[model samples]
Target: MRLRKGLRVCLFCLAAVTVLIMAVACSPSSEGDTTTAAPPTVKQPILEQDPPSGETGELETESGTESGNTEEETANGNDELETPAGNRNGSAGQLYALTFEDMMKMDEALNHEMNYIAVDLSEMTQLTEDDKTYIIEYLQGFGAEIRDRTLDQLVEEENPDQSSPSLKGVLLRVDKVEINEDSAQIEGSKYRSGTGAIGVKITLKLQKGAWKLSDSEMTWIS
Candidate 1:
């Protein structure tokens, strides 16, 4: 009985050691089974850049749009400028006609006021041959012919009170003038002592940078 009791006690001790070893192996302490829960997942935040705002950004956008519009407008304007309605040649023709008309008017005024006015004949030296001849013919109609008259002769003829008063009163009065490239026509009335009114037409030719009377004729309507 004593030997059996001792054997039983040794068996009990061995069983306890085996149970402790099993518990330790199953508790995740074994090298092959030891795994720590993956370190608490740390989420990283994503960074994003935002667009610019406010008046400065708006101004930039507006400036770009305005620049584009200006370029387009400038292109359109250039197209219009490329063509002109009345070109240089047309304008020059009109100017020539206008110049001739002005010269005719000046000539008519000078002739109408011949007696009461003193014209500086030196100023006439620059006149075209056509203009000189027109003056001479006009003076001749007033009974004071100026054939081959120098500048001095014309001055003496036009001096106030030198010629007869009756003759001066019969001088031609210009009514209208019509000019063309080659010719100009002057219409006027001659006043005489008892003859009432006589219509006169003087035709002038453009020659040598001047206008000269080419023809002088008288016509009676009444």
Candidate 2:
């Protein structure tokens, strides 16, 4: 009996030890485990952008957009194209202007060459004082004498005999003007000394409401 009792005590103690071993085996093995646990994360902040422009022009942005309008100058030095101012003197005024312009070479007196001007308009029945003034002013700057008179009004001859022939100044005259609707012709003569004389033919046309010199030819040279 005592042996059986001793065996039963030993069995109970063995069972208790086996149960304790099973509990220990079932528990997680934490020995020599070096894996680290993850840390807590913090929330990130959001940024705000500026509002776009509300005006009718261009939008201010980081990328690209062509926005403004560019203005260009017109013919008359203004923003818009405009018709040229009218000349109340009509085609006659234009004729006179072109005739004088032909005489005015736009060069200094000494820098200009002797050439036939336009036809004489002193006898023009339609000529105005303003037209004559324009003719005189425009004919300046050229090396010539502006005469509105006829050949009879000037010295008919200069030093009949060639005695050290000197420059007696140039005298240009144009008369015998024939005007039509679209085209006109004139005869001009230039006389400097007894030997210096030339005959010129000036032709003009009415173009775009403006009288322009069509052609100028030296008919005779002496």
Candidate 3:
């Protein structure tokens, strides 16, 4: 009976040790619940912001105004270069029918000789031999009838009072321009103190990029 009691005591001690080890392995830990870390969160970078309402409106208005100004400038530039359909005169691109303003300028150049050289020569021929010689030389420089006028006739034919049908004028005003291929007909009038008025036809030819006085005819004089 003493042996059996000792054996029971030994068996009871082994079972208690085994049970304690199992409880220690299976229980939840304080460190796992309170001190464990969580995963890190990602961050994004900031770039730009939208403009204020007033500033945005102002910018849009300025852009529109600039566009309008550019268009107006383009139109004005084109106006100068515009030509008639088919470029009827055959001289197209930047060279069109002469404007009235240009016609007036041409008339001025033509009449300059009539008022000064012609009248001056007519008066000079009567004064002296030297004056007559000078008048002849001067008239030679002119193109047509004035160049052919004899010295004696110059002295006798001078009619500054406009009683005779002669060209003596202070102004030449061009009123019409008729253009043909490489040529143009210009009609205008001459005005003088005593001569009253005269209608004249001038023909011009384009040669080497310039309008040259090809012919001139008097229609009527008063």
lDDT, candidate 1, 1-222, per-residue tens: 999999999999999999998887787544545475456789999899565678678989999999999999999998877632223222222222323233333334334433432122343343445444444444343443334433244435555344422233233345566878877776655432223446667677766655555776666532
Q: Give the TM-score of candidate 3.
A: 0.28
Q: How accurate is candidate 3 locally (lDDT)?
A: 0.52
Per-residue lDDT of model 3, residues 54-140, tens digit only: 999999999999999999999999987763232223232112123222333333444555533322222222234433343334333
What lDDT does each candidate get? 0.49, 0.58, 0.52
Candidate 3 least-lDDT 10 residues = 92-101
Which candidate, 1 or 2, would have the higher TM-score against the true structure?
Answer: 2
lDDT of 2 at 196: 61
Clashes of each: 9, 3, 0
- For residue 110, give model 1's deviation from the true position in Å: 20
Q: Candidate 3's error at 101, in angstroms?
A: 17
Deviation (Å) of 11 in candidate 1: 99
**Model 3 CA deviation exceeding 4 Å by range:** 1-44, 80-87, 90-112, 115-163, 169-222
Best by TM-score: 2
Using all chains and alpha carbons, the TM-scores for the candidates as numbered come to 0.26, 0.44, 0.28
